[model samples]
Target: MPPSRTSAAAQSANFSTISVTFLGTASAQPSSTRNHSSLALCFGGRGDTWLFDCGEATQQRVQKSDVKMGKIRKIFITHTHGDHIFGIAPLLAGCLNGAGGMIDGMVDSRMEPADPKELTTLEIYGPLGTRAFIRSALRLTHTRLDGRYVVHELRFPRDPPGGDYTTLPPHRCELPGKNLLQTPMDDVQWGKGIWNDVYADDLVTVSAAPIEHSVACVGYVVNEQPVPQKMDPSHYLPHIKRNKAPIAYLSRLQRGENITLDDGTELLGVPKRAGRKLVILGDTYDPSPIMPLAVGADLLIHEATNAYLPGIDPATNNDDTEEVVQARTTSRGHSTPQMAGRFARLIGARQLVLNHFSARYRGDDDVNEEAKTVMDAIKGLAEKEFCGEVVCARDFMTLHVSR
Candidate 1:
């Protein structure tokens, strides 16, 4: 049997921490220190891993990091940028073939789940061209999978994938290569600039909104569902003793199941406690459109594509200023550290983790490199705008967000 997935009731009081690990944090291309843009959001409570972008050589990064590829259940792509998505086909092929120690990864079971129509499918969510990109890559490369994949594309009225009309939104019927599911984001599925409830399960509800980027880019907001409240055993203990109730009742109650005692006294489960919300944006100059869902986020992971470190940045000169850096970064549809911080402050995020650093900035693996100093200075820039805990993300760095 598959490893038992923790239910919301079972994980109620566990309130375990969720870990966000940066697999690659480089912008545009790979440097010696950074790969590209990709991160792993691992939920300890659920035993599931979700990847937010799959840049080139991401599988290599996964091999090096503590993250287990076997647990990756879903992947969310920000846009159709090559650097943000080049690793997808290889990762999927590996999972389906169970090669390279990925034996337990989400695989093809052939057997249907509890639901009769259930297909052991890997789900991928992204922008308009995602289905075309994946299908073409998998098809052109002659890469086959034992299992199937479901691609959900957020369609924009103004933006559609150029040169790929066959795989465009309002998806065609499933092709037999292995039954790919392409579901289009319809009018009912969207608002002015937001795609509400892009995905949701027992643990979390994910939403997406358009951000200002050169391409049709969107950002995601993951709001964890409230867990059942901590059990107040004292209240039930008295009644249990008085009624000589079975000890098993306590366990059931802790699981948030209402129990009727021998005396016919009914005990209601404790109220649920609110969970945390996390906002993670893609390459963007401005992300104000998603403010409604992102306000008061517990954690915000924003891109910091360029910085104005005079002594460190290769582009920075004596006459260079943050304003100059901001203009250049925004012109390319990317954010600087200060821009990220300002957005974090607008959302009232408690913690800010900045990612997608330029190639000039080094990564954390080399302690002797300028990464330590450059990252600290970058974090300071964001901290100036957002009065929260600011962090400069490095490849393989993990941040734990407590429930």
Candidate 2:
């Protein structure tokens, strides 16, 4: 269990500050108001930006938002669909080419220009065909990245056999791209389903699991390390004032470290708080396979491409029943608001955020006479099933995940 908290980041507060920005929310086709599918999750005090799916016009969206392109360190691709990955090559190309072949000229998450010699390599993770798709696009377009990028390919039982131009085991050796790595995701060494430790840093960890979609798709679960509980000054301040003890004792206590004052005052360390977890999935008809990874997530970002609530929707079509609408959406390997809500309930998520909306239902920048009614119906459907907070995500919306 997480300890109670408030607004305070003591010196020991190296806690992950996870902020999620919906860069693009449109589904297969982008409307004038909404772009394609893309999400930016910024973590840590440095504001390291990690992207989930990069569609066409994503560069434009990033330029218009607060997300710094140079701060992008890792990109996690869901699948090889054009709409989900078209912007990768272009975005990476800009990062490498814009700085005269030196990425260090780019600003970091801290908004400070990195040292000229600090050339941290970029990483990209995705399903099987991701390597081929990106390699082909970059190679054919003659877009050479003077900097380094490693592509980590994931393998599933459903994936086809590996070969030339295929990202498979025993990868063909090539001149390492500027001493960068190119390899496959580690095998499923222990688990029956989940791919544990997909990616990890000092601040957080990411795990991957397969989701049911038309093509091979994977969902990611981000889990932050438990943060030290906030120190209750009332518990010690009065005592300190009475005793004239050193202030450094409080600092150590905040980090869950036991401390003893000069006069022999003993203070027990505060217990750590449970960290926040986020489960983000691509377009999917079902995602039961990720139950273990997603269950009890703090936030679940699921695709709700369509929704039809008989009494709430602004639909005039007499034949468009909830069943009909759901069938249509599921046929395309997508989910309705209620489906997303049901999954959220099954996973025991605390809150639900719905994205990857179809162009017809609009909000934020894209609004029509029926937009509010349609979007409300979508949220209503999800709330009806999940019994939790349901947000219909719009482009450029920012959400901070708190412990």
* Residue 27 displacement in candidate 2 (angstroms): 1.1
**What tens-digit string does per-residue lDDT give for candidate 2 at 179-205?**
112223343542336667667654577
**Where in model 1 is the C-alpha error above 4 Å?**
1-15, 98-120, 159-164, 167-191, 243-268
Residue 271 of model 1, lDDT score:
68
Candidate 2 regions exceeding 4 Å error are 1-12, 98-117, 160-192, 233-250, 258-267, 309-318, 365-369
**lDDT for 232 (candidate 2):** 81
**Predicted candidate 1 versus true structure: per-residue lDDT over 226-270, tens digit per residue:** 767767788889999999888778877775789888789998877
Steric overlap count per candidate: 0, 0
Clashing pairs in 2: none
Range of the 10 consecutive residues with the lowest summed lDDT in candidate 2: 171-180
Candidate 1 positional error at 176, Å: 10
What's the true lDDT of residue 366 in model 2? 43
lDDT, residue 209, candidate 1:
82
